[model samples]
Target: MDHLACFTPGDLQSARAPDLSSYHWRLLAQGDSWFSNATAKLNAHANLLQELVLKEKACVVNCAGTGEALAHMVDLESAPDFVRLLSSPEAPVWDGVLLSVGGNDLIAAAQTPAHTADGKEVPLHLRLLRRQTEWGPPSAGVARYFSEPGWATYADYLRSNVRHLLTLRDQGPSAAKPVFMHCYAVPMPRPAGSEDGGLGSSGPWLYPALKAYALPGADWAAISRLMVFHLAQLLKAMAADKAQFPGLHVFDSTAVPLALATPGSSGNSGDWHNEIHLNHSGSFKIARAWSEHIQNVLAPPAPVGKQR
Candidate 1:
């Protein structure tokens, strides 16, 4: 809501792409709650960076939907222009594209209790842990979210979507564009109810599933960390393959420093507003980090004629 003037209604409805002819630099962002963030106003972190930090005319199209629906909303074939600026004869080359996805995908799958090979229900975090018996060598973690038929299937889905985005960047009307993706911030799983209009109004987000697996409330902190860390590991692994994804980068929002955890501090926490979403202060911390990262990306290349 912060920059209602920045995006037209069509952009919000995903009906028509925004016109980018007037701006010197443009960015197309596609993803979920992290970027849209209805919970917090001033959802346009891009605008904040452009105004206070970069001091440039940066046009942003926020096509972030819910986690369950985001991938499809920005499908390469469906929304080809969702992650690229509108092409005009006089338009400057796009500065970059930002993708804030994958967290919701993982979150949805994680909340489901997957059945193990032995017909036992297991939480996602425990399934990923290496286990061994006294009589045999250690076995690897459940191939992936145990419910999934095969881990390769999910990996393929992620690979295909991301590959398509990178391909889009390469084929832009302008020169090759940088593609940046962000990892979700670490969220703690506390049992605070929605009494104060916290995210708990949505039912503790991932708590029911954790409870289904009989995980103790005391262990929620460690489990929460494990789940988030696992997702980060997967993303970092993909980003490390620079050969396969040139100019692709990840903004590690998970690394943002935070104050100590306080009891009964649901919305008061300096880092999180609830289990899943960040409060205003928390959002700014991340937006600032993103601003710095983007500034580096948008830096102009040294001039060839100035070599002397």
Candidate 2:
């Protein structure tokens, strides 16, 4: 049995959906390359968390994830397709949904200033304003062109999309299902040149972006760390607002000690395949965290001893 499956948007539309009712835990999500690569190796004995859960007869199904694809399926704009897939006879009510969004969205926005006409990054304040307003001035007839929106806009969208998904599920068969998401682990902004034959020379993935927007006179590494820290905080804030939304949980993988140990600091690139994705050892660590979180959520409550 396949523990993980990857799908493209087209693949999802045309392919027959699988019956997930028999599985102990059903998961729905769209992640970047990290989720794809990690889960693909999950069924093997090498994956510590996967093996542990397998003992409890746990099974998981990965719906769709691909490199560079925005994990925007939770957005309201994706509702039609999401409904079509979920309503199919083969689909089942999910136990949890793992959301792997926002990271790539942030990365894209980080690079936007470099790609602009004048090569001047939009002021952080103005960019934040645009996002806060939800991209502003709704025009029905005008075709949206190639203007770059800021990360804050995407952040707002991510939060809104999650709420929409929750509402949709709340009205359906999966009302009790919990939503799980993770904070991206920190990465050293370095190039993966021919020295490592893996995600080759994806030169300075975060460095250039951080350099472009970092505060003047600030250390680039510190800037990168701060950026990552803020992203983690954003996720935590979203998870903590339980009064506003329920059944939402976040796994703070970023807080794991080794995650912050960049090359020349506490460790080297041995834990990384590239500036972005993790190597086997690194992926295993993240997977273990995910596995533990899932197991804890699925565990039955201890019997309450009656007051004697």
Alpha-carbon RMSD of each model: 6.4, 9.1
Model 2 earns a TM-score of 0.68
Please tell me which predicted candidate would have the highest TM-score against the true structure.
Answer: 1
Least accurate 10 contiguous residues by lDDT in model 1: 129-138
- Report the number of the highest-lDDT candidate: 1
Q: What is the total number of backbone clashes in candidate 1?
A: 1
TM-score of 1: 0.69
Give the TM-score of each candidate.
0.69, 0.68
lDDT of each residue in 1-308, candidate 1, tens digit only: 12212453256457565556666566666666566524322341222222214546666665552222324324445443454343333333656767776766665555554566688855434333212221122252322223333334445566767776677666656546777777777677665434333332354566666665555556566666666666676667778888777777777777877553454455446556556666566766777777667767777545889755
Give the clashing residue pairs of candidate 1, or none.
2-42
Off by over 4 Å in 2: 1-21, 37-55, 66-83, 86-90, 118-121, 126-154, 193-204, 213-218, 259-268, 300-308
The Cα error of candidate 2 at residue 46, in Å, is 11
- Model 2's alpha-carbon lDDT is 0.53
